[model samples]
Target: MTTPIVAFLFLLLPVASLAAGPGGVPLRSAEVDITDQASLQRGARLFVNYCLSCHSARYMRYSQMGKGLGLTDDQVQDNLMFAADKIAQPMDVAMSLGDAKRWFGNPPPDLSVVARSRGADWLYTYMLTFYKDDDPARPYGVNNLVFKDVGMPDVLWELRGIQVPVYGEAGDAHGAETAAIADLALQTPGLRTPAEFSRDMRDLVNFLVFVGEPAQAKRHRVGLWVLAFIILFFIVSYALYREYWKDVH
Candidate 1:
């Protein structure tokens, strides 16, 4: 009984660590489902079109992604390959390091493990909360809700639409002073409706999570089987122990 309790507590450790957000801001739950092939495909397409130019997932191979997402080689080449030349190649960006530094003030970090480094919820909220910037010298005219004064521009602005920050009564503490985003209003309509955009972001985050650990789904399946075997073996051993003890009694 004590051993089971200890095992249960150990399982809860990872969940407890991820419960709090940075600066105590609540991170939205990503609720990623790696088995959802359609969502992964949509995320892959979105990533290739909007994010691939700047960010590289060099650790991920296009063929591996196709297999994981249930995409055919032809489909991946047609839809998920924008700047890349072939389906067998790694996900490399066309932008040079010097060019990226000059354009964005710093090189965009590789996103192969970003989903693992930053929780899915944080990534989801970070991508969805880009509001129009108040500053003039800022090239992108937008900033993030989660990451204040973020250097990267809002690349999905056209798809998600422009957002304006709404300020509450001054000194509300959760206002701009704390870099807290009180609220955001849609300033201009985008290609997708609000609901559609949210779904798109969710899908994108899901794909990023999958990319971070391509074998995650398989690992989970294997883990379940292993757990079942352990339980079955334990039950059989206990029964045998009882039978052996009955003779002695």
Candidate 2:
């Protein structure tokens, strides 16, 4: 029984690795500039336009988004909010999990904690790594370097264009893996260039960061006071310790 169980576990390893895709890269810290209101605003717009179709930020409220992005209730209602939205209600997309699973084979997961779950850099890299792969089994026929053979379609492919992998010697001593975008081409030339595209990704990541911890801004603001108190406590404790040591000496 133990031998069979071990064998089964070994079999799962490759499948798990494949599930992780090319580099088995997970999400990591990103240099997303959340302080930039314009960038955050742009990210909010892009998220509603592109991502809201499939994914939902169930943890966030529409009113919270409006407040964070400096938009009025009217603006959020007119432009960003979809469905029979109530300002106090959590911002959930209309797509049901069952319908999503039926359509995409895997239900799109809630993205409220995506930044927390995958980190900023992973999301950033995943967004940029979609390349063309003519696999019928794949809904998008696209592969990602970070997520590997992901089931989700590359919805931004038109704006980012197709990418092709640049491979190195399979079992080389260095074991290097590299890929580059073919011709730096985009299916449609947008207002943004490659650098700008990276910036856009950063912005989207910022919104995710915001969603991950709604109180993060407040927490950070309070952290300084906490740190100062801790420092003072440590200093007082050290002084008491020194006095005791001196008396003993």
Candidate 3:
């Protein structure tokens, strides 16, 4: 018969580690240039290659993306679009929600607002954090910190390879002299070394940043016009007020 203390310890152990643990990459630290045309174009290509199979930006039309990214309709159709889709149609993934759920146990979330909702940093970090663990219970023999115990596999594992984590201590930071530690370092390195992996992650993040606000260029141009109009209106109002005061005096 097992003692209650041993059972309590077993229950408490994994929970304690998971609560403060950190195996996934830190995503909130990447900085992306959304307005870089080359970067945006590269990002679009990468998205088509890696993510379009499972995820869709259902809110974005192909033509709108073409216009925003300065690509021609033919280019959007030939390169970026995977479906037999009309150029004017919104982006949709090949798989349906039901099919995705059946295969992966959950449908992949729509990416239309992921950048704005999760921010560029989180996305960037998440793309780089798929390490290999032979845990069958996890959906993909891997897990992510950005979306804990997510259903999606590390789809880019071929390029990235199996990752193992090196663990460390949290220590004194949260009060206890020997506080629980939840830090991770890379264990089994991948095909692309750390620097290359980081760059690819950045590219993906940059693309998502562009998707989040495709009209950013137009907004910047319109902003200047708006500011100019406001300044001119303020000057005219000041002159009008001065004229009225002069007549009264």
Each model's C-alpha lDDT? 0.84, 0.73, 0.72
Clash count, predicted structure 1: 0
Write one digit per residue (lDDT tens) for candidate 3, span 98-120.
Answer: 89989988788878778776677
After superposition, which runs of candidate 3 have C-alpha atoms over 4 Å from their true positions?
Answer: 1-28, 170-191, 214-249
Please report, as a residue range, the 10-residue window in candidate 2 with the lowest summed lDDT: 14-23
The count of residue-pair clashes in candidate 2 stands at 1
Q: Give each model a TM-score.
A: 0.75, 0.68, 0.68
82-179 in candidate 2: lDDT tens per residue? 65368877877888888998998878888988876566777887887777766686667788777767878888766665666655345535766544
* Winner by TM-score: 1
Candidate with maximal lDDT? 1
Pairs of residues at least 3 apart in sequence or in different chains that clash in candidate 3: 27-121, 132-163, 164-187
RMSD of 2: 12.3
Write out the backbone clash pairs for model 2.
Answer: 21-148
Worst 10 residues of 1 by lDDT: 12-21
* Evaluation by lDDT, superior candidate among 1 and 2: 1
Tens-digit lDDT string for candidate 1 (19-51): 456666677778899899999999998999889
